[model samples]
Target: MGKATGFMEIEREETIERDPNERIKDWKEYSTPFSDDMMKRQGARCMDCGTPFCHIGMEIDGATSGCPVYNLIPEWNDLVYKEQWKEALDRLLKTNNFPEFTGRVCPAPCEGSCTVAISEPAVAIKNIEQAIIDKGFEEGWITPRIPQIRTGKKIAIIGSGPAGLAAADQLNQAGHTVTVYEKADRAGGLLTYGIPNMKLDKDVVARRVKLLEDEGVNFIVNTEIGKDVTGDELKNSNDAVILCTGAQKHRNLPIEGREAKGIHYAMDYLTISTKNLLDKKINNEGLDAAGKDVIVIGGGDTGADCIATALRQGAKSITQFGKHPQLPVKRGSENMWPAYPQVFSLEYAHKEAKAKFGEDVRQYSIQTKKFVMDENGELESLHTIEMKKTRDENGIFVFEEIPGTEKVWPAQLVFIAIGFEGAEDAIIKEFSVSATSKKIDAEYGDFRTNVDGVFAAGDSRRGQSLIVWAINEGREVAHQVDGYLMGESALPSVVNA
Candidate 1:
């Protein structure tokens, strides 16, 4: 809103990414930081609309629209445009606890709902967000703002993922002692391992963790509440317990030869690769994909990540399989500007794959039937069948196999990249909360479980979703927990960072 005609005068400028051929050579972030001028120009593209639905963190007619954390997108953009970076960051942090992480990795539903996008190109909201944070770090404005007073209340957060980190930040800022428990050797949950390094560098995650630790927040590494610390001990020690464990149990494909040694879950493959990179050098890890034909199942971001990672590892060949038909070349009427247009898109990984190979490595309406393996228990090929939609047993929806569509494709390794089911059952069981098929059933307003003082947030409550949603869940849950502990609380549930 700095200039009345800003959106009309300035065009959106996206952050430049490193050349694919060169970036995949090592375990590091591929996207480059925008220059000061470039970022300022991008910020200038914000219309900062009257409604500003860009940061409207709420639902619309039962459809998920607007930002999840309700980030003050236009305010921060104007601040950046005016070169008031410190103020911009303060505005950014008002709703979002970690713009540094989500700015880089989130799908940016805010941009999707931008009013400018209805007619003109959407503002470079995500790029501006990342730039503000990057600048904060450079200028030392990203220091921990620890609370000045203590509330004498203690909170325990399980799972050191984005959700857990966000919850800890909120609860601690409420002047309550907070401790985050992580089962992994390192602190950041999937941020450390589930995602490939090329997309998000581990160093950024490490820096954030260090900052959180210095903020007087306690971190217990390699310790799980259910396994290491008993639930009773945690409940007795802390006034309230919040579960932020993400939905990580992978959705499996039911097919023949599913137990083949060379066939594995995409998370397992990425976890080992990331762990090796963190522990030792990535090059030294034995997960080399050189000279192997790899087949990745599913067509989500994770599947595309596997394709990119394999290509970077010098895989001989790579192919991806998807069940749904390909989207249209242009946006449909229902998917006009904003509303997260469901049109054909080229992500970083897919672009890399197309550049390395002759074409995009994706096949629509294709499904894996079985894993074909060699006699030595090694995978060697894939038996798949073409599928089409048809009515089911209950007259709902089902996938029907096409006759004479069976085929065998050569593959040395296979990765199942389907999405997750829910949070791990161990801790969920230990809490002994009333549950649903996917997540725990807690009172909506209070976020309290059936067991008193125990709460569920993030993916554990809402199911697997964007990192931004997890942050909102954490922030809101902290407010409820704080209010429950004290007569009242000042913690903000101000959604949309």
Candidate 2:
């Protein structure tokens, strides 16, 4: 370890962020750069544990114990402390295909599993990772690596999200002719539209997409499989196809007055706002929340993104609803070290709401009873009831409405960010693939669909999950595809590692 007593000598320091009030004025990224010295100090906080659970990603009680991408966290932290940033970048990229994307958007499960976190704060692995990749870009170290020889085997990836991109990157590096098809007008499916620009700037996505394009991966935008092109056509055109179409089907709140005009899906709202922002439009063309009382349903990252987006759009007031009770501020014993903890913490949007409105703007353990509509079928307010979880005769927990807790709140705009159910069924049907529920039926390890020579990965194969897991699945699927094509594969597997 660099400086054997470095962990004892240095206190953990987080990356500085732009002022909330100032940052809320624009959609640009709010994170400011850290000095090289500050970064080294933060890197020094890594104890570099003997076990190093930070890189030993495994499941514990159905939750991710560490980073899904299996990033070489300690190795890079030591490199950063030694001021070997270029070497740090190399280690960071060994397992992760796109550190840039994960560095910005990942929830940092690695920190939760850090051995140092058993006592003090976890090492700032995410920030240190971001620093390494950012330096690599500034030094012009990141560039396309074109393959020397072509395998002459053509492959089709059906989505342009993290999983699809990672798979394409691996397959292309192995000298396969890879082409990605994105139904959206642009590539980088969720990265381009699902996430807010403040969290992950679209330019960053475009930059990586460009790099992949230059690396001999072809991306076809606005061309969807099963619609623009048929499954038979894809089978005829390519030697094999990997479906990475993400789980984008938004969950709905079917309640009274559901037909109200102001009710909108969170993805639709976020996507439109981003599209307008990219187009340089002064107005979001009715998707803007200016001078509106916005109520976001669901207390998740998507809800947080909606609140932040609304704040940028000048929403007069915002409130988010959570069906579950608030978690304890500290981790409970049941969720001990190395397990992804469920604890209460303020997210960026919550902090922004507190700064702007003088309140946290979140209500826990509440259920939306119905949407109240005014004249002309416009959403005027929301009716809600407090809920308490209780066991039924079957000993199964279910939400029970607490009597005398019914209330109404002014909500001209409502966003349902309750998460996704699965991928679009139309796309699933296009390949005549077997499906379990809304998700494509693909083996977790193999990522192969029931249809021969067809595969699935990412949110479409697994349910909706983190960007890191999607990237991991993509990399894994690419290896399997290579094995199927070449009869012997050299691509690495995160699962095997």
Off by over 4 Å in 2: 282-285, 390-396
How accurate locally, in lDDT, is each candidate? Answer: 0.82, 0.90
What is the overall TM-score of model 2 with all chains considered together?
0.98
For candidate 2, write residues 1-497 as lDDT tens digits: 55577878888897688899999999989788777898899888888478889876778878887988788888889899999999999998889989989989899889999988888888888898888888998899998898999999999999999999999999999999999999889899999999999999999999999999999999999997877889899988998999999998889899999999899999999999988888877665467799999999999999999999999989999999999999998899879989987899988889898999998999999999999898889999999999998789998779989999999999899999999999888888899998887899998878888899999999998888999999999999999999999997899985644
Clashes of each: 9, 0
Looking at model 2, residue 325 earns an lDDT score of: 90
RMSD per prediction, one decimal?
Answer: 2.4, 1.3
Q: Tell me the TM-score of each prediction against the true structure.
A: 0.94, 0.98
Clashes of 2: 0
What clash pairs does model 1 have? Answer: 69-495, 69-496, 69-497, 70-495, 70-496, 70-497, 71-496, 71-497, 72-497
Which residue pairs show collisions in model 2? none
Best by lDDT: 2
Alpha-carbon deviation at 71 in model 1, angstroms: 0.9
